[model samples]
Target: MPSRRSFLFAASAAVAAPSLPIEAQHSSGSGREMKQLPPAIAALTDRRSEAVPIKLGEREHRVERARGLLVKNRLDALVICTGTSLTYFTGLRWGQSERFFAWVLPAKGNPFVVCPVFEEGRVRERMEAKAATLPQASVTRVYTWNEDDSPYALLAKALKEAGIANGRVGVEERTQFAFADGIAHASPTLTVVSGTPVTAGCRAVKSTAELALMRLANDNTLKVYEAAWKSLEPGMTNRHVTDLIGVGYERTGFPGDASCQVAEYSALPHGSLHPQVIQEGQIILLDDGCVVEGYQSDISRSFVLGKASDKQKKVFDIVHKAQSAALAAGKAGTPCHAVDDAARKVISDAGFGPDYKYFTHRLGHGIGMDEHEWPYLVRGNSLPLESGMTFSDEPGIYIVGEFGIRLEDDWVVTPDGGDMFTPQSPSLEQPFSRA
Candidate 1:
């Protein structure tokens, strides 16, 4: 297999990468202008199609991991109702309805699903299709319970039939709480253990296939950000700019959820998206991305509305350098916290250590079926960066009520090092200089 860095370099080379043209252009809505591109950073939009496919192997790998956990935990079977975990293990994408919702992956027997007949077609199309493609035997034994019947009864019957009559049963915290509670109530002998952590641990590590899809998702998001940046102005409302960003994601043929917040200074790092108006000399922070093929991308960036000050330029440089170093340090066999400290050190050394109050969030998180997954890059996480795992590398420096600067990128850890999924935007030197 090609190293992550070499793969990215080869991918970049194959695109006949064009020299990014960096210039400054004034917005017609306001006299404010911004940089066209940063030097040395090529736009990833050129090769979004090159992203790897999320294959059947990745799905099977997760199911096998769950089975391993079940045997080790001494559980007869595990019940999953969480949307992501259910989808990850059994390929069931049906939503929780007023009726019962669940699926069972037994330690020794076949996997089973409990859903309403109303969602039969959707379950087949979205969930069953995935199961059919896997190497595992067709394990989804559907139990169609009526909307009026007790969903817990149907689930318990299925579990009992599968030889799980009297042992520890695992349940997802989010979706299975009610149904699992009902099942445990019906069968007092069965122990209901929290299965959320087991599920998270199984899916947190990325398979090569999952990493490929994430790379594509993030690549498409890069274009969306560019379009949003171009359409932005001091006069545009936060809603309007965010809407435009959504359009960009859709226009590029990669669609998911796109959300954002734009604030002057009051809305510093990690500020909530609210009703606000942009103004001159203000900063714009965006937290947005799109989901593609069930996998999602979550990214954040900050820009200046009109002209920025020398202080802002220096801060931006430091944040960028820090994120770059963190990305460089991220690789298989390295501790997760070390990656975070690599970025934190750059920010602290820039003389903002005292002012930097909120730079302590995890530097990154796992990306797959869900936007926020596990194996977080935070203090004492200690999870080693494993090969084929993809994660975000975001580092920021923020003063709650004053101002903030953040830079984010996604990377896949290889046996040797990491590869950036979304390359940073070309330099903003011209924008900062003119501002």
Candidate 2:
């Protein structure tokens, strides 16, 4: 297997391999002034189809691993309701509805699904496609209920048949309250516990296959940021920048989500709902990401629309140092709070923060199948850092009514230390590193 640094160096070089122009000119064909900007980064994404993707076999391994956790914890089984957990373990993409739909995997027996009667065919079709992942010998057991019948009763019966009618059952952390109540009501003898030990246990550590998808996702996102920044025009509003971000991601072959904020608006972390137009020489903050397969990448890059002021330069450099500290501090066996502390100390020492007053949020969050997962880089977490955990190393300093500076990149925790998914921004002059 290739090292994360070498893999990223190769991936970055390949994605930006095309000699797409660094600068281009275009007009709206109406009365608007022609704008000169960088070339669309999407052109580099044409090679995305060549990337190897996650295979079905890896998902099978996840389920078997979860079973081991269940037995060790002494829980009867975990009821996987409609969500990413279901898909993560079973490769079944399901949506949540008022009606009951769940997967009952007994720690000691075969895994079975409880679904609506009418949707059984669709469920079976999905299950058959992921044939290698289904619990052994449970293909014939759909165990469904109708609108007039109780799905909970059906699930209860399945549990009884599996010889786990009376024992502790772990409920998904995100399972709706009604589902928990319904499960408890259906079977009076079962105790419920949080499945974080199992869910976060399996998800926080990225498999090689999982890391590959994330690598592609973050690489594509950085390229999109490059293209989006190049395509910027002085008159464009936050919404316009957001649209082009989508264009760049789609052209790169991934569906994406993004938001933009300018000038004073950037001082607010999530940005304002009101429209803010980009102005040349003012602060321009571009933060967005795209999803590669089921995995996700979240990156935020901040730079000025034109020449940055001296104050902007100082603040930008400070935030950059903060990000660097967190990255340097992350490694195997380090406490989660230590990463946040490292970043916070940098900002505080620089006189921009007394603590959380300006550097508002935690250092970063663990990223995976969902945008946010476990092992967060926040105070009080105390979880020891382990290899294969990934997080955003975003550090920022906000000056209300003046400006804000933030630089974000995804990082994978390695055996020796942490490795970034893309190169860090070296200065305000070359935010995208076009130079």
Candidate 3:
């Protein structure tokens, strides 16, 4: 019987020989193969150079936390296939492709990655630098799959070479059923189980470093929101306003795929901003985000096109009250649902509880690496808010087809209290002139 350490050592040595795919090896072409080119990233303009840098230490902490959990679980290795988790651990910003490649992370050794040849250079140059600072050993091995050899075969071989046979092999929440089934069939001795909680628990809390990037992301989002507000016109269609917001994001050096959503009648919780032209008295809700580094910032702002109606003013006021109540109730050590209840109670007292429909989503979610992270603010989520944890303090009342009112701001639990990441606007009170 091989000791765990010896097993990995022996397998690593035995697998050192380079392996090529069958298609590449037995090409029937006229003695030459057509070479494929790497993907082209869109060229960035001069203005795009100002994109913010993400704090790597926070991400490193997230990875270390997960590694610690793996050790606690007595697992020999983890086969992380989830895109978000992969980025969190390796700092490699690759997306899911038909390629079926993966990163094999051993609990006590260097990480081994299997990817197409085209991606190896970027992954080593960029991601390897970040991985070097990981709490665990940062050595890495790379395997490139060719046309003949499937990436799945490479991954299974890599895992076995790492001595995972008859061992607990960790898999992600979104890992394909087909892939998992294939891996098990490849090695019947391997025991695969869900690694979601292990990953989620590791990423739940934000570190001080993560909070700093989140602050900057929120600030960037606010600037874009201000631009969107300035671009609004009485006759502009909803799509026009939305497109202008996208332009603002670009102007601010945000990534191309930055997320955005516009709501015309927030009172109708699901009301979407359509092609209708904005008139003098319509309310517009813009919920958007711009990517900074690898993290995301999600924020929402509401604006009045030209004037405000009496009904709109009352609705905005109630929504503002609910938002404030929730903020006040949010603090480190408080139950997650407390803030939700606090906001809901205020809306109920205003006689809009039944009409409100309990604020369409959770009070907020973690805001780093990915938009919706962990420690959600909803009924029955008892996780106590902790310092360094951030969430959106958005409270709203929707009445469907008529209008909706929502005031959203990002908040981080601090030693003193909740630190509001996004600043409130001076015009926040403008819509209340009808009172």
User: Which candidate ranks first by TM-score, i.e. highest?
Assistant: 2
User: Over all chains combined, what TM-score does candidate 2 have?
Assistant: 0.88
The alpha-carbon RMSD values of the candidates against the true structure, listed in the order shown, are 9.7, 7.7, 14.0
Model 3, residue pairs in steric clash: 22-148, 23-148, 265-404, 266-404, 267-398, 267-399, 267-403, 267-404, 268-400
Against the hidden true structure, what lDDT does model 1 obtain? 0.66
Q: Which has the higher TM-score value, candidate number 1 or candidate number 3? A: 1
Give the candidates in order of TM-score, highest first. 2, 1, 3
lDDT of 1 by residue, 152-251 (tens): 7777788889887788888876654557668777676688887755786688777766776787788677666766666565666555555555445544
> What digit string (tens of lDDT, one per residue) describes model 2 on residues 1-435?
122323332343343322223233243543212133235644545547745665666776777888888988888888989777877787777888898888877887778889888999998888788676544534437888989998888888889899987888888888999988898888788778887778788888999888888988998888787777877778776666765665566566776767677899889776666566789878877666777777888888888777989889988988999999999889989999999999999999999879998899999999888777787999998999999999999999988997778899999997666799888998876787734
Better of 1 and 2 by lDDT: 2
Estimate candidate 2's RMSD in Å: 7.7
Model 3: per-residue Cα lDDT over 1-435, one tens digit each:
122223332343243332121112223433312122111111212244445454456555666676788888876667766477777666665666566567777776667877788877876776556645432334568788787776766776777777665677777766777767665565666677777656776766666656666776787777666655654556655544544554455545664222122344445443432335566666676665666766667666665766677877887777778877788888788888988888888888888866336456666666667767776888888888887777888787776666666677788886666778876542432522323
- lDDT, ranked from best to worst: 2, 1, 3
Show where candidate 1 strays beyond 4 Å. Answer: 1-57, 116-131, 134-139, 144-150, 257-267, 354-356, 425-435
lDDT of 3: 0.63
**Candidate 1: residue 253 lDDT (0-100):** 56
lDDT of 1 at 90: 55
